[model samples]
Target chain A: MHPLVLQYDGDSEEKISKIMTEEIIIAGFGGQGVLSMGKILAYSAIMQDQEVSWMPSYGPEMRGGTANVTVILSSERISSPIINTFDTAIILNQQSLDKFENSVKPGGVLIYDGNGISRHPERRDINIYRIDAASEAAKLGSAKAVNMIVLGGYLKVKPLVELQNVVKGLAESLPQRHHSLIPMNEKAIKRGMEIVNTVHEVG
Target chain B: MKELKLMKGNEAIAEAAIRAGADAYFGYPITPQSEVLEYLMAERPHERTGMIVLQAESEIAAINMVYGGAACGRKVMTSSSSPGISLKQEGLSYIAGSELPCLVVNVVRGGPGLGTIQPAQSDYFQAVKGGGHGDYRLIVLAPASVQEMADFVDLGFELAFRYRNPAMILTDGALGQMMEKVWLKEPKPRMTEYPEWATTGKTPDRERNIITSLELDSGRQEKFNLKLQAKYREMEEKEVRYETIECEDAEYLLVAYGTSARICQKSVQVARENGIKVGLLRPMTLFPFPKKILREMAPKLKGILSVEMSTGQMVEDVMLAVNGLVEVEHYGRMGGIIPAPDEIVSVLEEKFIKQNYYG
Candidate 1:
């Protein structure tokens, strides 16, 4: 077993087990791993004995354009997997924020890249968390790994599943050689966790 | 036991097909309708309910795969948007000529060729009047909402087998992308009952029924054509469905379907707000064309304006249905351009205002 798999605490496990029934949405441009993020979240929920649904939005010209996905995790059977509004929205780009800001239910959490998104959203009713994950991941050598950094941001706001459990889910879901990439993700996750923890402490 | 939940029209159709005991689904991806395939892929009911789903190389393969599956007496369906659906015409016509039962869903997008991924109801004539060569007809169902999207799956499949012909759900991108509350029924737990006429392979007593369109003899081919026409007539009598909106004392009736109907609904509301007394008649089934209702309503109205996403495909149907009982005119936006309710209302005001008031 990898150290990343064991990094999750018992409290996170209890939290995940307690409220595994939740709907999550991850959205961004084509290369942002929006679909894979939904897949990982759905697979993790499935591993936790929850009913899961993952829907990816892709068209013929979706590449290099706007892309998004909806993931549903619930205790009971889900009827239709398409989510018109979301409880949690992870937006990685400005277009994702623009297209999805109105779609978040009031009081829902919105996690976005602070560096990538310049303008603050006009609406202040919903909970918004701006993460400079792109810069943080850039320090870790792979700017493309910003998705994992945002996943870190997701953990702080909606930590329904344990960080270690997510790592384990990724390990089980991804191929073998990809296992080497886990440590960087764990680092990114910790960086994300610190931001949320600081915000809570200050508030 | 009925319950309502908000759903997109595309997802509702997928859930409804699952509930209707659809045994197989084969399709290629296309916008406005991709959610149907995405839903089936995520649900994977094939593993639990003995269903099968295959993403084919193209729309041609998908429809042919459906024909192969339907020949085995299995309830199967395939869906595509405009351009992709045009590719399935050959297989659709062959299925019709062979009298096979299958369902084809066209969640229409704007098109002459990949014109745009926006909603359009331009395929009315292709769906109802037979897109391919032959004296044949497909039972076409046009759903206007998420709830109806789900309900029409069962209705389309039932009528497909009932008439031994292909049934089409003629929806548009708006219906495919919009969301609403949908009440889903529990899955039907039994195998679909097929008629003895269906081509089940290699059965001892049946002598391996040949499913083909090759009646070499001219008289035999004519006999098959007449038989098909008779079956279509029976379907027209039994399966025609339409909705009349506030036409009790209307002077002008707007004819529309699918996403166009939603726009027309708004137009009717706005026109009524202006005291225009303009009502709407939406044909849920396009093939049967709701000819009887239009004929009956024509005498009561001054004229009918056939409004659609296509330039004038459905206008012809409106003309045929009214059979010149009253004046008929057409208003449309084509090449994937969606006409707004206000635009349609302007056409109505322009066309009818002079005739009714000035005349």
Candidate 2:
């Protein structure tokens, strides 16, 4: 039996392949915890026995400039840690929105915070969602929870990883001294999942 | 016990070195590869396996440190980026010339002279054909993933000792910085029994052991050179390693190594999805160059494309191997810019399926 057809009911050959391989790009400012989110996501995939690769943007731009990371979670061996397009792009800032809005493959998902985004995503071929994570973080009195909120918004839409695995990933990646903050981060994720607003849906 | 962990490439290599029972590591920190020294320092291999990890003042100093450790037949290694690698060339030549075993890792960045701190395979030529001035070759292993980054440290050390020559893991910034899951092998205790040629001091029961690359007599130097050539030939005959994907029915083949090879794997899948029969040939051992396999696969291939992160370095070797049995071309993106997978298929289609049709 073909691996791609594990859930097959004698249907289409291209059935559900996009779900098998999730090529995600998370981009924002240097201190946005963007790389950490990618790491946690990669670790979560590892706990599920999925092959994962995380490549970060560590050029001159990452020196207090824009930061980005490409995270791939796949059932098969992933090729090319570097890529031009993405299956999902979690954009945080205005610059990232402008750069990667059009990079989402047709019928893909785009999740971004509405904080710095002045000109919103203008693509109609992909599904776009808005999360006011900055405001939500301010409400929680923890500005550092912005990334988790946005990551939560991403999970509500895709749910590619189990919630328990994500929590375990959060605990595993965090230092023992910082493990007490996990509950707050989990709460921020729940708030994000609740507040994610749909903007444009392709289908 | 098999330990699995999600680790960056640099960290994996550092952890693997200690587990491989390496005696010492001397290195200077450079971007895209700084994590290696950092991880080593944090892990404190001196505590784990009693291995010595030192941060040398410069790349030159570090490679010489490796040379010193290797002279005593210790499993020693050093790592650096491009400009730092250029600084260690003289030391590399000396190590190769003296027939000492050592591992040198060049986590390559863009270069001519300090080009960029981004990933690139421009060092392919420098790595395969001796960068330092001499008639010698370093056993070069190009690792494509974080797993290979960890796995190659042991393989690199094994090969270096097998031939009594310097071995290098020629990876790029992308592989150095990326994070992936790797299953680490169980630890091996450090070697207490050194090789016979080691400078372990003269004793009443044995003759004095000397290690040097200098031979003042021209005739003796030529003989040494011939001996080195024979060693390299043996390596060529026995040590060529590569990986093939989707080639059973492939009409076109993409030859690449390291990060470029990873990208070409995706190109093979994309081309196949488009009803095109494409395959990927990834050379794991870049020094031995995988010439024998290419020669055998070339006759059946309608067209061959050499994809690299640099501009046409490895293509020369591919063209030489194929000997024009099939049409060959080169595609690349320079200055730390990685080529895309889908675009590689487009180049294959344009180059082979478009106008020129020769086999």
Candidate 3:
């Protein structure tokens, strides 16, 4: 059996079983790779032989507009892909932060990139973390790795999936021609992991 | 051999069609379903399996192309969303009337008109009751997951050719857009020879096959209609496919199909956790309706809730199937809104458990 599958066994640690099911919403502007973040995370879960679903807003809503995707990863079968609330919300911009902050479940995690947010997350019941993913990607000389950076921050907090699986997922999600950029993406993820700060939390 | 891959439902359908030895795919681009065409184009099935993929000028042209190809005994299909499907209704009716074997996929979006580009099962009545004009029915298969979306392509074609009729895959935007792991079937080689009934250039020793829906003689047309009815009856008898979970000792039953069925499954889990005896009945083939199962289970259930994305389409079918043996209620969210599992659980409790248990 896959190591990840064994992690969900009944005798596994309580923390592993408690977070076995992760419902996430990633939202941002069209070009910010919000949907791609969700796609990569979903792919990583699939690599671990986990049940996963990724649903993105398509068509006009994705053309120069706010785009979002819902991703669910579970040890068991996922019943529905479309969900109203999320266990985690990865908001990349001010609009996304405003739109999705309230949808995060109480005690859930909300990770946001500080680049586009003017108003901070106000939710008291949820854990909020901020990472400057855009600046990190810019520093790495690849502005497109913003999503990867955000994903790295999410993993650091949640630790639901392993980083090696995420690298494999990145190769699967991107075309072969762009594979050289994987190293840059990996750098961005590590930068995100190092830079994320917890802004708010509940006792 | 089982090869597992993560794929969107739309992409899975396209790959499965090619693997199923589909001869041609004719479709216009439409949201939540464009991946079906996009994947076919990207994969270049023509080069791989010699399957032809064409982007027609419109959905009307696409359905007509499917009709033309199917008449030649080629495994052909077309896919579209709700509004685009409306455009193909005329061609669909002609395909059914002429008794052509083909696949028509509708990745349904919300609708009465050009509704939201989100998932909705409002097309349930249109698909199962024959949306096009005439006394005709297309064998309808409802796929809830990406795996089913892939598997049903071959199943739909098999049933279609078995009865010499068109088969429709009725799915919603959520199922079409969502990504999941799918175990792809082994690729079947494309058919090189045409069947005897096909309009493949008639041989000198055989009578030429004429493909047309128009029967000049009214009496002959009436007889043809009766033959079609008999075929539908056969399908109803033999093709009713469904799955039941925890129905053996359940006080509450939920009837749902496609994406709604997935949500209802979650509701079943939640209700069970709360000590409510809730079961889920998923209709795999919507046209056959799984009436027999419902009729049998209705007597043992305290109440049935028809959960759907539409206001109340399949509920009517449930009521008809139950025949007033139990109280049937519908809880739905229209205009592309999906009801959450918690919402479904609350509604189920209010409608059945609370009223009966606390009253």
TM-score of each: 0.67, 0.96, 0.94
Candidate 3 lDDT for residue B97: 96
TM-score for chain B considered on its own, for each of the candidates: 0.95, 0.98, 0.98
Tens digit per residue, CA lDDT, model 2, B188-291: 99998999999988879998999999999999999999999999999998888888877767899999998999899888878988999888888889998888
Ranking by DockQ: 2, 3, 1
State the number of backbone clashes in model 3. Answer: 0
lDDT winner, 1 or 3? 3
True contacts kept of each: 0.00, 0.57, 0.43
Most accurate candidate by lDDT: 2
Clashing pairs in 1: B5-B181, B5-B182, B6-B181, B7-B180
- State the iRMSD of every prediction, in order shown: 21.6, 9.2, 9.1
Candidate order, TM-score descending = 2, 3, 1
Model 1 scores a C-alpha lDDT of 0.77
Q: What are the per-residue Cα lDDT tens digits for candidate 1 across B251-328?
A: 999988876776787677668768888888878888887888888888889889998888788888788878888888
Docking category for candidate 2? acceptable
- lDDT agreement with native, every candidate: 0.77, 0.91, 0.89
Looking at model 2, residue B85 earns an lDDT score of 97
Instruction: Name the regions of candidate 2 deviating beyond 4 angstroms.
Output: A1-19, B356-359
Error of 2 at B208 (Å): 0.5
Error of 3 at A155 (Å): 1.2
